[model samples]
Target: MVAKMAACTGSKDGQDSILEPLCFPEQPASSTSAPSLQGPSVELLVCLFCPESVPLRQKDVLLKHLLLDHKLVIGDVRLIADLPKYMLYWRGRFLEQPVSDFCSVIKTNSTGPLEKQEDYFLLCDVLPEDRILRERLQQKRLEEVLEQQQLERDDSSFHRLCMFCSEEFTGNRSSLLNHMAREHSFSIGLPDNIVYCKQFLDTLQDKLDNLQCLYCEKTFRDKTTLKDHMRKKAHRRINASNREYDRFYVINYLELGKTWEEVQSEDDRELADDEDDDWSDWWAHPVSAVCLFCDHQSETMEQIYSHMKETHGFDLHQLRTELNLRFYQQVKLVNFIRRQIHQSRCYGCQETFECRDDVLRHLVAEGHVMTLPDASTWNQPQYYFPTYENDALLCTLSDSDEGENGETSHVEDVPVIAEDVSELRALKQSSVLNQLLKSRGCSS
Candidate 1:
């Protein structure tokens, strides 16, 4: 257990009166309790307004005193880089000057009928001094973390055994961590993603020795019982609400006021919102492409190609080879033919017809399937976008960059998750997954 410190009731001023003492422990101690995992050690937190008040263990207790007695409320305590040092600096400053000099005061019941009024001080980074203090603390912390990261990366004397099996690992801490995850299915996270490897491992080892569940934090009778409970209940993961593990992750140190989970969750929320977005304005339409020779519409490019070859004796693919048409060139030719047919005109002989059917009859009767007006007549840039918005033919147009077997060569799309036809991967065999599957009636 962490050794509790003796409270300093000794006043800094000339006052002779003694006060009650408060005590706490410095971390990296031998403890079986939850506080041992709270990576950093914060010991003496002095009251801001109380000169004779002893140092407090928890910052919340000191904040309570300030809020209740001094009417001082600190805004966004989580945003403070270093709370102990921050409070100490403010404590000294409060002694020299009034809090109103650096704080914004709100008088309660300003416009109310009540005669009595009370004031509350908001101590945020709104003041220039506080903003500078927070920024300086953040810079100092970043430098220290970077230095520590270099030391950890270079560390090689690490030696530990697997948490589940008795396999001993040397050279780097990741070896042991990876072994525990692979063999025991206990993954805290990726090795490269975290810092303070030694202390984090120690905290987990302490919990295991104490026969505690990592998730629920419940004490068990024995190691066997604890392991069984964790496996059966799917409690192999660390507690989500436990702020103690914050220091172990490098992401917690990267952002000013956000953790890795918070950053990751923001991305997840955006994707979820995108999935939930309203697409009610969209209406379903036929997936049909129009024929180049006539007004005949087919659901697919293949069907249209077949109909043109049979009815008009026009093999567009053959003509494409004869003219040595590139991908965009083929697109423009098809679009030009379609436009001419729609306007009741023959594109090959440049003859106007009474209707679309008359133009198709004229092209076939005059044997103008292989004939054209000119290269410049059909190879315009305006045919880049298909004339018909629902044209499936444009999607299947072959390109030199699309390999020998281009988009015209169809391949069915398959899902990433393969069906239960063979053996399952190692992840699917995990106890946690098995428990979840069993709960959902997917496993017997």
Candidate 2:
């Protein structure tokens, strides 16, 4: 469906047209051809090998080191039939995950323990192009062997002349010629040692040039040999070693001093009340010289020791031993004061109450009427309630009886009942007095 959409397009006339025909009916389903993909020139072909030199029994130790140290991913693996008992790391971690995605099973450069080197080298020797290169090299060597045999059998006079110098030579003419051409400047016929050796070395050096290093034209024979040299500590030391050491030491020293300066600056800020303008606050002492716990200061000596014992539960000897402090006599003292304050109670009943409501309840429950202290008769504490009536008073008495009988009142809470109870109680009280007058034959 995607292919069809990709292939279909619109022409200028606004009609749909086939931009490209999708591959379908003609193509075989069983085609094993690899899909074309754009990739890097040097593909990262990973390989991992765990040597027996390590103390650990598991190969995961070495695989973990590869990921942690070298930053490589192990893509896929095929078990070596001869050594199927060994453990393998499928990816970045220890895993038994299926690994069919990789081009091949690969082992990385893990070579040590003298016996492992040959096997490791053999594995490296088997690169994807290695077989073809080896065959070509073998054929070339065979041709050289045949040519050498023919030269040995030849009795021709041309054998007496050097191949390189063209000078007369009797025995082993080819060797003498190679010696002259490779080592000494003997002939200018084709190429001399000075010109060709310099050029050849230059070409070899160019082939081995790395991003950070240049191979020495005078030292190594070829690029591979130069690479071997590059792996050595001496060669690295010769190339940008100063820069590496300087970079590492500079980073370490800077990190060390950075923490020191940070701590010092934090202490300075804390002492100065975290304010840049308050420099004097760093040195200023508190107004009171008395210590909070012992109530002692720098002023008193003998009384300070006594205060330490009574207030802080610390004798001079105990304080000195446990707290690692100097003489308590060196300390000063301030007064430690303690006192109590009494609150007022109800005047008539002498009952402790925080507010007016409790005093009013006391008076009402006792069947006593309340009036101001200046009134002719002072029976109870008085409160101003303009809405109070006899009918409200009787209703309150009925609600109180219901409460004493363990019934839930229609009123929800204290605030609502408190607001309406005073008026209801007053109304109930007046109604009772009127009924008493009617029963006594008095006028309404």
Candidate 3:
């Protein structure tokens, strides 16, 4: 079949045609079943109360005029489908009855001490007629959008020359839409996802012909200036806030009684709401801290220490008291013991066994629990790390400055043991570890 004008308009004679209006060959509309975006619709929103007000193609302009001048506010004007028609219906009804009958009056804006407070009218779905009108318009808009979608989907007479280049496309609306998107970087959306293809293009072409920027709507002196402004400003698309163009996209009409934006955000809203309902109290449970030497595990650090002291005869409290271990020293000592036991070696004598049970038996039978290797051997810099990933025993290690009455001690994140390393004599004589280091020398 020969291509006809739908998306783009030109008498394509196999050459680069100028962007101009072309005729669409007549096709059966099935009048009772389909609605078209052709002919005059209510494109301009007129003030509902004003008799001689300027016609506003922009909804925002019309909305502001109504609020400031007429003291009327239309609720969620963006969400309202067929905004002009909705306003027109109310304009006619305002003449028939008192405006206060269908609207809620809010008295505000006191200009002076002598002047009376002005009353502002809120026209929303609180009234039954307003609710029914919104629902009816939404239902009508959805039906028309759906029918237009089917027409474009089955349309075969799509022919047009590129607005930016000399490329020509014939048959399948997507071919022209895709080419424009791929070559010129102009995309309204996927061809199948849009309705009213002809009207959408015509609206853009009219703006280009008038030398107006599609995004900013500023009029330029010439087509060259307009082209430069659009390209430089990255304005290759229509104005998003202009609700007049909402009828072209199928997404805006996909849902009833809700905006497309509201529907899309439901998942995010649900996740946020779920986070507020936390069950931290019910889900709380104690994670066990493992013993330093053996496989003995307890729920708390205190319980683990008690079990190790009673069962394995490994008194860590006695060692800390004798050595006057600081916060980091205790951390290193627990890690050192843990590393040695994991390698199936006794921390006391440094003797390797086939398994952990064999090492535990050797340590117990040989009475090497209190007999530790030289301080120089185990007190290397590498022992600062926790050998176990979530070493629970390290959590109970207190600072040397902590009082015997269970008072908390001041300590920084980094260990302060090396802070007084300059005073070698005092460190060597005061702590049992330094004394052991001197006595044992290099022997383990």
* Model 2 error, position 262 (Å): 61
Poorest 10 consecutive residues by lDDT, candidate 3: 1-10
TM-score of every candidate: 0.51, 0.13, 0.44
**How large is the C-alpha RMSD of every model relative to the true structure?**
25.4, 45.5, 24.4
Ranking by TM-score: 1, 3, 2
Candidate 2 or 1, higher TM-score: 1
lDDT of 3 by residue, 1-444 (tens): 112213132122322222222221223344335555454464777678886344545678778888888889998776677887898899999989989998999877566553677888999988899989999999988877788787777777877766667588777677788778877888877776788887787788788888888889999999899889889999987777786677778887877546556667677654555556776556654666766565456777778778888998988888987887776777888877766666667778776665667777889899987677887766766678766556667777876444688865556643555634545667657778766777989432
lDDT by residue (11-109, candidate 1, tens digit) is: 233231111111222232332212111355645777788853434346787788889889999988887777778888999999999999999998998
Query: Tens digits of per-residue lDDT for model 2 on 1-444?
Result: 001111112133422222111121121223233322212123222334333223332335554565565443332222121111122222322234323232234344436665543211122124444334334444543343333333332323323433223466554333343455455433222211111122232333344453333323235565566545655623422222232222111121222123223444555535544345745536643222232221134334435445545644434334223433221111210100000001112323334443334433544465322211222122111212111121111111121112557675453432222223566667765897777988999864
Task: Output the better candidate (1/2) by lDDT.
Answer: 1
* Clash counts for the predictions, in order: 0, 25, 0
lDDT values, one for every candidate: 0.70, 0.31, 0.72
